[model samples]
Target: MRMAQTPAAADGSSGDGALGRVPPQSIEAEACVLGSMILDAMAIDQVVQILHDDYFYRPAHQIIFRCLVQMRHESKAIDLVTIKEDLVRRDLLEKIGGQDYLVALAEGVPTSANAEYYAQIVRDKALLRQLISVGTQIVRDAYETQDEAPIVVDHAEQSIFEIAEQHIGDSVITLQDLLRHTFEMLEQHEGQLITGLASGYTQLDELTSGFQKGEMIVLAARPSMGKTSLLLNIAENMAVIDQAPVAIFSLEMSRNQLAERFLASHARFNLRQMRRGVITPETWTALQTAAGTLETAPIFIDDSASLTVIQLMARARRLKSLHDIQCVLVDYMQLMLYSGRATSRQEQITEISRGIKALAHDLEIPVIVAAQLNRGPADRPTHTPRMSDLRESGSIEQDADVVMLLHNEDYYHLGEEGYQPRGVTDLIVAKQRNGPTGSVPLVFLKDYTKFESATFGVEQPLGEPMADAPF
Candidate 1:
């Protein structure tokens, strides 16, 4: 006849298809049903998908399976009341303890009952759940082997409409899902379709949502052209206002110097007064408030004078995993060197660029690596830097998805009064791979070490060009 079912098989059958197999007598006492579904081995999403069109479950029957899924996902015991209410919502079982007491009771689920209830339900739905139990065993084995977070690799060349099929050879979604998923796919890629990540500049945000994640965005300028200030502005925009974590890798300046400069910019205090001493109450209050705001801001600063490429990658990974860093701000590129290998300056920089790009892709975050333009630009009459003018343009441009060269006319020419902007640095978006390449005029505050969006007569869409092409 049929093979004899073990006591554990009781985990798969309840009353020969009654309400979830009522919690078994105990973990030791299992049912003798021939085939039981363990469900313990499935992905939470897979479990949900498996039960999407369950012909047998009336909301109540869904509870036990759901409880099992939750337990596996959380690695914790399930709450009975929550499960009960979910059942009640489907008109499966009479509202446990009425709808009023339902929530409170759900909040107080005992572990033994939760585990047993889920297991017992599996017993009742044995035939329908065999795969789940098998999956559970597989998952247990995998988890035992890997202590780190599981890396899920999507080999599908096309990101859109990627279908997920179950073990039984049944596709869960159809043509409708494909269409909806296309729109949703675009929604997921919002940052990639736009430029700069900060939301502070309304127009800039409109032009480019922010810098795309997994990209190397260079912000380059000469010695005193508000490069650091522009950096602080972006940090403030992303980390402060938009609430995105931004990392700053400062090689040239100390932590204190960067802070002092940022404070001077927002506080509007003379750099000499703020630095040399003589702090007024208003200025002190402003400094204190700025400090307080920055205290909780997700702006990570590494003012390491001798930061190596490998060390930077290590730090960036640590930040991406722990601090949830979304964007990177490297003060200047030339200052960075490779620590792991020995090579010439060009080789070192080449390795550094490769490492930075890899870091961005690995972390799936935008990396803003600023750089220094060569003397070629300085030697030019107008002093506008070309892509070749970048200190190490070959490696930098090759690795970068977007290369931006910041140019401020006022910084180069001091004499012109009206055109000479005291508080503006125009950000030149010299190159863009995904869309049209053009200059975006961004205001640079020399004092605050920040960049702000300057609204113009017309707001051009991302693919269009602006009229004032200063760069």
Candidate 2:
């Protein structure tokens, strides 16, 4: 013979009944959580961090648990007597069925050892409830608003992202755990050739350790200083050589234009010749080989001209989910728009920089962003860029983990006697949070619009002169 089921139990509804249908509640799990907390005072330390009062399915349980948390927060004991007194002082004792129900709760659990298990069940149900709430709000907004479809979609994405972040519990790690993980990584890297991703440039990789994860690296330079070319070089190296997935957000150039530059760089041919359809047989053969190589490369490009930071984050998240992109490169920072309304350009840039940094941290990947330096570098005697020369310097310099400025001596010392540093460029590491700051010498191939590692021999001019160079 079986006992009859209560109305609430049969319908899986809470006391409030406001949810209408079952809204993903776990009453038994909630009772176990409370029982564990009351049974063992020390169990509150763990359960308190995992759950809050609102997670309870019943209003009475919510009231009781709220009292328990308040008592614990004030360094009070968490036993039955102390919790009852705390509830009484707050006038919630009778509301929660008084001392009798509290005693029943403690007696309901077999032991407090399974507290974490019960808490997990409660958390999962809470997450499902939050999802339902977010879905309901999205539906409401869709029906009530006459806004653009993309704007509504962005709102929905932002809401879901917030809920996802909230559900990412227990992110904190102890120092001992970090140290152990670091030691294991070092042990694995002991006899390995390279630890981080290879930049394909020996000296630059030596300096940067190949753009570590969760780092925001800012590559800034004046116009025609080969910033875009250097970014493309790194992208090609990572995608084609290492077979890593790479995403490039080109705010300035078209996808086909970027492809043309890549072919010229890869085949060591003149970009102008390819653009003008004046290729020789050898050049055509090399072009065909470069095209084949690129066709198999793991690279993705988005050439949206007026992209906002919010849109960029949404797209990057999608790419990360769909393709597992290992690295991301934004063509330039100044072209990115701030999603929020700003009173000045500086404010907009600050918001954009902060948002990019947040995106890098959230995705746990390296984000390389190109920026333009102010004219202050040109006015200086040496024409070397400083951290202050970064346009909208305040936020960018503060948020970037590493700031690299590109300088071409050939661009500044044009037509000077004995000034033959043609195709020579300096990658000034002006700011590095975890490493030394210095210059990494590189060679800029003028004709192909590419950058390569500087070799140790007598420097020879390659390809066409700077007069006909297209940036």
Candidate 3:
């Protein structure tokens, strides 16, 4: 067996004391990982996902590992003889201490079972070294004084986030592993319960099996089609009925306005009458009860008027960390500002769409975003919106796991014959990545600014005020 070379001390000192060092590393862990891979040919399969060539502290180990990985990729045997022959073919065998070192590595490991554990140690130390590099760059940027503080800070945060993501390690799952997880999920969901977070609407829940985690749902509609109202209704259902913590980013409405709509919806009172302070005694009692219910619901609202997608992600992360929010709702994506350096409006919208999808994936939560449709529906005869009519860009439709279009037949045929289906709204599920697409009927209560199941007959509320409602 070849003799192993001892690495210099990490701290920059001779035999005496030292102060500054390069970065944190574990040479022993790197050697153990290499030794394990050399001991058992199949051990490379277990550690290959965790350790890359750069993870090795020793250059010879890095070269040896690279050769092993290439051999494995090519479906070749990974014993010391094959590895040495391949390295010799590339004139790297002598550079990496020849066949004797390979023999030494194979003989050093006690067992191949701890290969993954040793690889993890190497990976963690490599991550620390990367973090130190990022920190050093950040400090240098801080002292340069060329850029604005906020810009520097943003750059630093982004760099750190990228490092953290890299250190999250191999997320690739074999089909066998994935199937095992799927079987577990199926067994756990063997009962009558929905597999995902319940939307609280029986028909929609049945259609979607509830909104699955890491999904992006796009709800689109033209003006006055009650998309926001529908979003609020779902949020209400999830938060109040399911007791799931929800965070709402209302770019188009204020907190008070959203709260007022929620109160009106919950209390079954006319929003206009409540706003004008003309509610009856029974309405007052209902409003009091509704307020009490909503006061206890785990619903959080952020009504930032000029929120950018970056700011929204930061806020969503904070909400997730602090409140453990189960779902996120962004009211009207078109109103949100795109803080990225995209040139065109379409590019900006694309960035925003992609950002929200990434956020949902990163947080492993379902994100429901309300969007606006263009004037294509107005020109059409039936006036039903399609996925192509999504405003600004088509990326929103492409990024969404489910795309729903709200169409109010009443808006298009208000004065014609057999027109204006009172309180009836058609929620067209135009695109569903994992389910069937169809229309789910809903009742739009204009006075209360809410939506309910269409099975509830169109019965106007008692003591309806004859005034214009502001929504």
Candidate 4:
């Protein structure tokens, strides 16, 4: 075993006490980690997994670790002599305390067995320093910012989250490492009917396998095409039947209006009649029962009239941490506000779309966002929406893992010749990043404002509205 040296200020006290208080650091641990890496070539791999070069508080240590990593990547042997030669070749040996300092580091650690532990100590201190720095910046922003309070608060939350995410370690992996987890996932799904959260539509679930985690699913349609209804129905299925917590952000509708729609759909009553004072005793009983069921369902709604993507993501992050929500649904993307820097409306939509996709990935949950199609569909003869018809920006289609365009033929050709009123709506899976694309038919009950699989033998509500219609 080598004798350990008494630790000294590796970089001569620059960052040690510059901020009034001593910054968090473990100089001895950093030295031990470096020494172990030099002592055993195998220790380099283990230590790199736990600590990056920037984790070292001393600039000299940072340079040395970075050189060691580069040498490893270049398939060079790592030892006290070779490290010193490489640093000299790079003209950094003198800056990092020269050949004597390298020898001291190599002889400072007893063994390479504790490299990981030393690396972890360095990492913990680095995280503490980062937290203090972020906290200081947040205080400065709070005390001297022209931005609104909400914007400042969002910035603070984002900075802390960035630090927390850094502690999650590296996400890159070799195919060999990935296949192990892939096989385990396959084993878990060996006999499963659905590998992801089911949409309660058999045909759609068969096509999608279910809405996958870390996916952005775009449900697009023109106005009055029942996209919101379908979004809510999927939310109901996930929250109520699948027993998964769901977060709904409705920028277009008020909470009371959404609640009324949910009640009408659940109770199988005419939405217009329910809205008016034409409810019967049976209707009241059914409404009460449906309300009771929804009251206990893990369906949380945020009907913020205006929300930027940053604010939306912050809320979703908080919801996931608090309730472990499995999915998020955002109603109609075009209505989303973007207060961030942007040159054009398309740019704003692009940022919002990208942000939503990032939110889904960061939270590891499926995010279903309702979006609008352009009038290109209306100008066409068959009125089918293409992927190009996604309104505002093409980024919506680019960021989405799956794009489903809702189309109801009856809405366009209700009283036309040779038109059949089956109340069938086609959910066109226009773009699917991982699966096959096709149209899944759903039966839309206009009276109840509900949607279900068309494969079922239930009578389709077609043609004219009921006598008490408010349309």
- Best candidate (score: lDDT): 4
Which residue window of length 10 is worst by lDDT in model 2?
462-471
Q: Quote each prediction's TM-score.
A: 0.58, 0.82, 0.78, 0.82
Q: Candidate 1: where is the Cα deviation over 4 Å?
A: 1-196, 340-342, 415-424, 455-471
Estimate the lDDT of model 2.
Answer: 0.81
Give one digit per residue, the lDDT tens place, for model 2 in 46-135: 887788877776777777677777777788877888888888888877767668777878887778999988888988888888889889
Q: How much is the lDDT of residue 2 in candidate 4?
A: 41
Instruction: State the displacement of the C-alpha of residue 403, model 1, in Å, after optimal TM-score superposition.
Output: 1.0
CA RMSD per model (angstroms): 14.2, 6.4, 7.3, 6.6
lDDT of each: 0.59, 0.81, 0.81, 0.86
Cα deviation at 369, candidate 3, in Å, is: 1.8
Instruction: Please give, for residues 63-90, the per-residue lDDT of candidate 1 as tens digits.
Output: 4344445555665533444445455666
**Residue range 1-471, candidate 3, lDDT tens digits:** 234543343212123311265466765677678888777778888888788888776777788788877887899977778877898899987776667767777777767889989899888887887888888889889998686554576578667766765744456779999999988888976763578888776667767788999999999999989889999999999999989999999988999999999999998899999899998888788899999999999999999999888787777877887899999999989998866667999999999999899889988899999999999999998787778889999899889998888988788876788654665787877777787666777888888988877886432221321121110
Error of 1 at 219 (Å): 1.3
For model 2, the stretches where C-alpha displacement exceeds 4 angstroms are 1-19, 69-90, 139-155, 167-176, 191-198, 276-296, 392-394, 416-418, 457-471
